[model samples]
Target: MDQTTTARAKGSRKPLWTKDFLITALANLLLFFSFQMLIPTIPIHLSQLGGNNVQVGLVIGIFTISSLLTRPFAGRALDILGRKHVLLVGLTICALTIAGYTYIAAVTLILAARFVHGIGWGLSTTSLGTVIADIIPPERRGEGMGYYGLSNTFAMAIGPLTGLWIMQSYGFSYVLLISTILAILSICSSLFIAYPKPIPPTNRAKSQRFTDRLWERSALLPSSLLLCTAICYGGIVTFITLFGHEAGIPNVGFFFFCNASMVLLVRPITGVLFDRKGPEWVLLPGAAFTITGLLLLSYANSNLSLAIAALCYGVGFGSIQPALQAWTISRAAPDRRGAANGTFFSANDLGIGLGAMVLGAIANWSGSYALMYRFSSTLIIVFLLIYGWSIWSYSLHKKAAH
Candidate 1:
């Protein structure tokens, strides 16, 4: 009926798949594949290096902590230095650091490499959402983002399984070599995409001191909510193999296989849901799915039960992750989108680190992965309560304002 409404509808019709979008999506795939390939292999490598559960958790988690520290800086760089430049530097760092792993044998050296690797991960990944946001039509942001996120989702499905198979056949060095190649391919892909020109900060924003530039406060709530899921994920990534061994399952790769497949299948639908129904509805079910999966994991005795658990977790993760990221973008001001992404990722990395270390400690103390998983499952319940309270409070605030 209204001219503005008509214009907005037309804008939303802008094509989702452009040349630049394809290049960026491929670049995202390569980047995530390089990282995801190592997710399970690294813990196994650490175990071979004679690390205890706690030490293994620490090594696994320290990467996220390192990445977390660099995210704010990376966000700032994306805004000021430009996305392409920051992304290129990050990719180079990742490629070189991964290559270094082939020569590394000592645990200290391995940890050092992972630390540097995280900086690259933090910088490149922080820019990815920002780049996709810039390219996609604003009205179709949620749908486009869900599609964009599938790059990572698809990689997650294949990466671990491939990496584990390679490690089983060849060695850790070969896995690192393949990861390095993927990172190099990602760098080549990124070069083809024409990145958006960096937006200059406002006069007021420019005047603000260093600390003010460090966060996008508006993104904090969804970021915090995401943290809950990420923590449980870290535990799974870091310890699932050992858990599988304890349960007498010979091949734990099937868990990632099932998990990744479910995520790949469900993510597109969840993206549609975010665009059509909003994030609130998507996130609650996502959380419920994850909790159910974790609870199943705690009680699982057979391969069938484990597969079911993976499927549940995968669907939940697929739904929640993109919706939370879409909500983060929706809440932020345009100029601060990079910062919002950075903040959201930082929260994700922090939760992951905490989960690995904390859950590892629980495993150590209880002497059972089942008990640890049960403990981890409780965290989701806590997060749900917190999320519910926040939603209720926000509703009340809106009513009062009206």
Candidate 2:
């Protein structure tokens, strides 16, 4: 048998963990830990700087806008410029911007720093996804990605809690220092990874139109679905702390802890299910869980209710996200995987950015975070409808082909 077939057979027989995979996963974990540490805390920081909800949303959302804009170009660059160079530069930028947060005395400066940070985020994340895709065995992609996603989950579980505690105990400056250190460590870990050699762009790849280079068509469906889900996620990450205060809860960070814990539990199972069954089986139940969680969260008044909502949302999001990612990668040609990852993440950033801005406005207009969450739940319903339509249309197309 040829090497590809031989590798597949071996992969099927044994687990797909390599030293490179472990190091890469570690790097991803540290990178996300640094990012996640700031997700909930930044709004609080902005609030202390005399920013209102609208300003908070703009500052937070603008980061994703810049990240979103950078992703398309970053994706193309990965295909041309080589992964290590992109990854290191991105990490370095992230570290510097994160450190700059400590010195910012005004919300406007924070906004500018966040925007610059997004560029690094876009570049690093796309490169990481592409690098991991290269390391993973195709036959076991779902499983590998699930395990890989656990790194993010682990970061989510600890990063927010740690950040909030540090902010509460020491101050925001200490939080920035620690986060910057974590990001630097991430860069260090990435240095050890053996990146795959870039495949030289074919003449056709080189001659592709500018617009065509920005996205991969094969990834559109899954990316679209992920975008919808990310909108809801943006609301949670951006406002959950404020919501907790509104509901009279003492500690809001527990919600993230519970949510991430459930994700840690569910991701592996969902990954296996996706490998054995398909995206449909994982996605349908996941959507239901997410919708239910959102509704529950909208009404949550106590820790118990919050925990329940978090668990449901966690199961839904954790399962759906990796499945969509694996689906996106599986559909793309090897040389185009970077672009596919870019498209996938771009959709994510767009959704989050839009969600933050729109939902912030809703929260301000209604003067109720609870009402905002109720509205957020509706978007997932849209996700369900779209997915249902896609499935129906796909079935019809298959029947016609047959």
Best-matching candidate per lDDT: 2
- Residue pairs with backbone overlap in model 1: none
**How well is each residue in 1-402 modelled by candidate 1, as lDDT tens digits?**
112123245643778799998899999999999998898899899889887777776666678778999999988888888899999999999999999988887887888888999899899999877888788765556677778888987888788878999999999989999999999999999999898888888886688788778788788888888888888998997788889989888777788889888888888788777766667678889889999999998888788999999999999988888878877877776677788889999999888777877898999999999999999988889879978888788789889999
Instruction: Look at candidate 2 and give me any clashing residue pairs.
Output: none
Per-residue lDDT, model 1, residue 52, is: 78
Off by over 4 Å in 1: 1-11, 40-59, 104-107, 168-173
Q: Write the per-residue lDDT of candidate 2 for residues 184-218, one digit (tens) a residue.
A: 99999999999889888778777889889778887
**lDDT of model 2 at position 88:** 95
Error of 1 at 48 (Å): 6.2
Candidates in order: C-alpha RMSD to true structure: 3.3, 3.5
Q: Model 1, residue 15: what's the lDDT?
A: 83
What TM-score does prediction 2 earn?
0.89
Q: What ranges in model 2 sit over 4 Å off? A: 1-14, 40-57, 102-107, 202-204, 245-248, 364-368
Q: Which 10 consecutive positions of candidate 1 have the poorest summed lDDT?
A: 1-10
Candidate 2: count the clashes: 0
Task: State residue 293's C-alpha deviation in candidate 1, in Å.
Answer: 1.5
